[model samples]
Target: MSRTLMSLVVLIVAVYLALCAALFFFQRSLIYFPQPSAVNSADSRLKLAMPDADVWVSTHERVGARALIYFGGNAEDVSRNVPEFAAAFPDYALYFLHYRGFGGSGGSPSEEAIAEDALALFDQVYASHPQIAVVGRSLGSGVAVRLASQRPVQNLILVTPYNSLEEVAVKQYPWVPVKWLLKDRYESGKYAAHLRVPALLLAASDDEVIARDSTQRLLENFPNGVATLKIVPDSGHNSISERREYWRWMGDVLNR
Candidate 1:
């Protein structure tokens, strides 16, 4: 090879390595986009005191045996779901967790930290509401699936869920080594095998974010007859909630 061509090859390799290094160091920032809570009233908030940080839960208190716990998308403000959820599930108490560093919660978010916080929330909720149903959307789906696997949840609902964060990352950055670089891999499929309760995997017919195959892969992970997949017509990943069928399916799952 000519001296000039050798130098050009070296330069290209250096630039590629630098880019990979940057991705490895700051991947979490790209993954989590925290948003402020919409409902900030005292009555609607529940402060959960963890050992390291204080996590906030948007709640609708109802005196009953049933309850629903929700985990929202990476950029979603779970507080926004309060009014609709309250009206839709009148008999069930509702708890929508504001993940660490999201809303007014303290500390940074990671897969492990959020999982611990979820377990704590489930323990607290399960004490009063024996029949607890859990719902997780987008990124929160990973948190919800892992929680249901470990706890005795009555029902599980996953919206626009992926088989694994690593798999999604691989597709997004085909040139980069996502499997090795990713620190917080929310592998929902691995945990789904352990879930014994009934689960509903809700997918959008035109979801632009989470690929349809990813949702199908997660469904395959569950035990036979444990999970069912339903599609909401004419909806995208972010707009799935706007469709009436979405809520109807969720209601059917929670009621069953």
Candidate 2:
């Protein structure tokens, strides 16, 4: 081998290693986008105690056994959904969870930490409300899936959910060995076969974030009749909830 060719090969290897190292250390920053709170919590928020941080949940107070627990997107401020949920289901108490480091919640966000906080919230909600519906969107879908599989969740709702974080990460970073590098693989598909409760998956027709095929693949993971997919036309991943029909569908699902 020529000296120049060997030097070129060495440079390429060094660059590849640098990229891998960067991804390994800063991967969480790519996954979790913790945003500040826009909604005032003085009127309606619940502080769920956690060792790492206090998780803030937007609460729609209602005296009933039927309640809804919502887990939202990575960058979403879940407090934004509180009003809509209150209007949609008057009888049901709504609790929208803010992932760690997001909204007013403290502590760095990770798949494991968020899941633990979710489980804590579920346990507390379940104790008071015997029949609790768990709703998760995007990143939260994985947390909700795991929670539902472990708890006796009455209804499970997934919005723009993917089969696995690793799968989605691989698509986003085609050159990266995501499977090996990823520490928090939210593999919702893995829990699908174990779920017996009815699940509703909301998909966006023009979703630019999560692919339609990814949502479809997640539905396929569930057992026959275990889950149903509803595609919101002319809506992308983020705007699907903005559609009027979206609330109507949600109302019908929760009411029934």
Measured against the true structure, the TM-scores of the candidates, in listed sequence, are: 0.98, 0.97
Against the reference, the lDDT scores of all candidates come to 0.94, 0.89
The segments of candidate 1 whose C-alpha lies over 4 angstroms from its true place after superposition are: none
Clashing pairs in 1: none
| Model 1, span 88-151: residue lDDT tens | 8888999999999998999999999999999999999899999999999999999999999999
Each prediction's RMSD to truth: 0.8, 1.1
Cα deviation of 117, candidate 2, in Å: 0.6
Best by lDDT: 1
Residues 126-167, candidate 2: write the lDDT tens digits.
888998998999998999999999999999999889999988
Q: In model 1, which range of ten residues has the least summed lDDT?
A: 247-256
lDDT measured at residue 127 in model 1 versus the true structure, 0 to 100: 92
